[model samples]
Target: MVMSLLLALPLAVGLWLVTGGRALAVVLARRITAATAGATLLLAVATVAFGAAVDRAWLPELGVRWSFGVDGISSPLVLLTAGIGVLVALHAWVEVPPGGSPATFLGCLLVVEAGALATFAARDAVLFLVAFEVVLVPMWVLVARYGDAHDPRARTGAAQRFVLYTAVGSTTLLVGILLLVATAGTADLRRLADQAGAGLGSGTQLAVALLLVLGLAVKVPVFPLHTWLPPAHTTAPTAGSVLLAAVLLKMGTYGLVRLPVSVVPDGFARLAPALAVAGAVGIVWGGLVCLVERDLKRLVAYSSVAHMGFVVLALASGSDTGLQAALYANIAHGVISALLFVVVGGLKQRWGSVDLAVRRPALRETSPRLGFVLLLGLAASLGLPGLAGFWGELLAVYSAWTPAGDRPRVVFVACAVVAAVGAALAAAYALRVAGLVWAGDRPDPEAPRTPDTTGVERWVIAVLAAAVVALGILPMLLLSTTADAVARIGGAR
Candidate 1:
């Protein structure tokens, strides 16, 4: 019951807003959305605290069930999604992008949140895929209809690319899920994991792993599959950007863990070397792009590619420590990326553009608060000590340096070396951003001053910044929560 309400609240409210409530006044819409988001967060907290679950028959003929629950593995993600939903809703008080009615925009955000929540909580293979698809159309609406008002064509193209790419990935993912279900003769994820691909032959497991990995890699936006990301991030509204960075990208990584790593371990092991290579390349590639990327928002987007590389590399290591590192890095990136996007998105909104190449007044001089937060986010991004980003990257490299016995040591070690270089690249770009935006080009007293963050925006950034600090200071807060579940998944004794 509690689980059901948690998923249904945002979804039901959002559906109404999109359809019957489209004419709601802007302020009214925002208030309602904020309230709905807040209630959903509370429900999420209760559900996680109480270990709430719901499982029942949904399709007897197909052997599917309506199952939703949270464990150590999913609890954090559920909380993050619900919390971010609230933040995005509060952000509506700050700015509503001009491409659509306020109600419709807010509705889309709620729906996306609900979808992400459902995705995280789903306990059935087919249900996971279904929940995954729930976010697609709403996210498309966000990028297409409520994106950058200045360039409709670019927004449209980005939206089209987002849908087209992910649509293909989804179709592929569906096929993979069907194959897994048919072979395993069960749709329940818990049973599938318990079986651990026991009855399936190596060839079948490999085939399922390939399809699942390929399909999810696009959503994770792995190196070669990540081209659609920058454009979408570049043009999305601030709220949209936050969800994209913090919430949407995570679904892919989580799916990789839930589907491939846990259910098809042998096949994933066979593919680990290749995944390690791709991850290492992405780390360097994204950093190189960030070093030269002129657009601030896009630079941040590219940085996501780099950060997520660490996650992929960690997961490919195939150790208990590796899985823990992957999960830790996943959450860390979500918080840090949300902080960065919120700051960068706000900058873009105020300046009408965020071209780092163009000389501008110092953020420190004009907008000290924003400047401070920007520096903090950049510091965390570069893996500064005592910050959220440091431990995850550290663990990731360490895990890769010493992977599982079955993994090719030489390949993983080489990947670790490359990842270290990528870490250095991250530092270079972080300082570059700090110097260009935070420090300013030259002391120009006459230059136009960008307004500092205030009100709801200031509060939102502050809360996220605090979370980064808290996570950094107490990494165990999340690590311990996930430890038991991770051990179970890794077959740790």
Candidate 2:
């Protein structure tokens, strides 16, 4: 019952807002959305605390059940998705992009939130795919319909690319799931993990892993597959950008953990060397692009590529520390990225554009609060010590440097070296942004002064900023929660 309510509440409310409630007054619509999101967060917490689950026969002939639950692996993601849901909803108080009814826009956010929570909680392979695809339509609507009014063509293109890439990914993922189910004779994720490819031949495991990894890699937007992300972030509204970065991107990494890492150890191990190379490349590629990228929002999007590269590399290590690093990096990036997007998005809102070339007063001189927040985010992004970013990257590199016994030491060591170079690149670009935007030209006496964060916006930024610090200082809060589960998956310990 708890599980059912957890999924249904936001989905039902969102659907109504999009349809019958499309004309809801702006204030009422926002209030309703925020309230629903808050309630959903509470439910998520309850579900996680109690280990709630719901299993029912859904597709008897196909042997798929409506199985949904939370475990150590998924609990943190569930909470993150829920927490982000509340932040996005509250952000409606800050800014609502124009293109559709405010109700429809807010509704879409809830729908996407619902899908993400479901994705995290799904205990069956088929159900996971279904939940994964649930966010695509609503998110596309968000990008295309409620995106920046400044560029209709770019908005349309981004939306189309998002759908195109995700659809292709979903197809591939479906084929992989079907193949795995057929061969393994079950669709339950828990069972699959327990079986761990017991009777499957190496060739079959390789084929399944390839299909699953290929499918998930697109959503992770690994390197070349990452083109769809920057434009989408650039054109999306402040709230949309936050969700895309903090929530949507996570689904891919989580799927990688749930599917490939947990269920097909041998095959994933076989592919680890190549995946490590891709991850290392993505790190360098994203950081180098950020050094030159003019649009602030797009630069953040590129940074996500770099951050997720750490996650992918860690997962490829296939060790206990590697899994822990991947999960920690996943949460750390979520918080840090969300903070960065909020600040960058706010700047874009007030300044009309975040083009670094434009001359303006230094953020420190005009908007001290915003400047401080931006600095904090940038520092964390560069993996500054005692911040949320540091431990995850540190652990990821260590994991790759000393990978599982079966892994090729030479390749992983080389990848770790590349990742270190990427981290240095992260520092260079971060300082570049600081010098350019945080410390701009002296305020023109005649020019308009920039606005600082205030009201609801200030509160939102404070909460996220606080979380970054808390996570950094108390890493055990999250690491210990997943320790047992990480140990269970593939017996890495």
- Residue lDDT tens for model 2, 225-322: 89899999999998888888888989999999999888888998999999999999999999999999988889999999999999999999988999
Checking candidate 2 for backbone clashes, the offending pairs are none
Q: Residue 121: error of model 1 in Å?
A: 0.4
Q: For model 1, how does the per-residue alpha-carbon lDDT over 177-260 read when each residue is reduced to its tens digit?
A: 999999999999998887777888999999999999999999997889999999999988989999998999999999999999
TM-score against native, each model: 0.99, 0.99
The residue ranges of model 2 lying beyond 4 angstroms of the native Cα positions read 441-445
User: Considering only N, C-alpha and C atoms within 3 Å, which residue pairs clash in candidate 1?
Assistant: none
**What's the CA RMSD for each of the models?**
0.9, 1.1
Instruction: Evaluate residue 64 in candidate 2 and report its C-alpha lDDT on the 0 to 100 scale.
Output: 97
Question: Against the unseen true structure, what C-alpha lDDT does each candidate score?
Answer: 0.93, 0.92
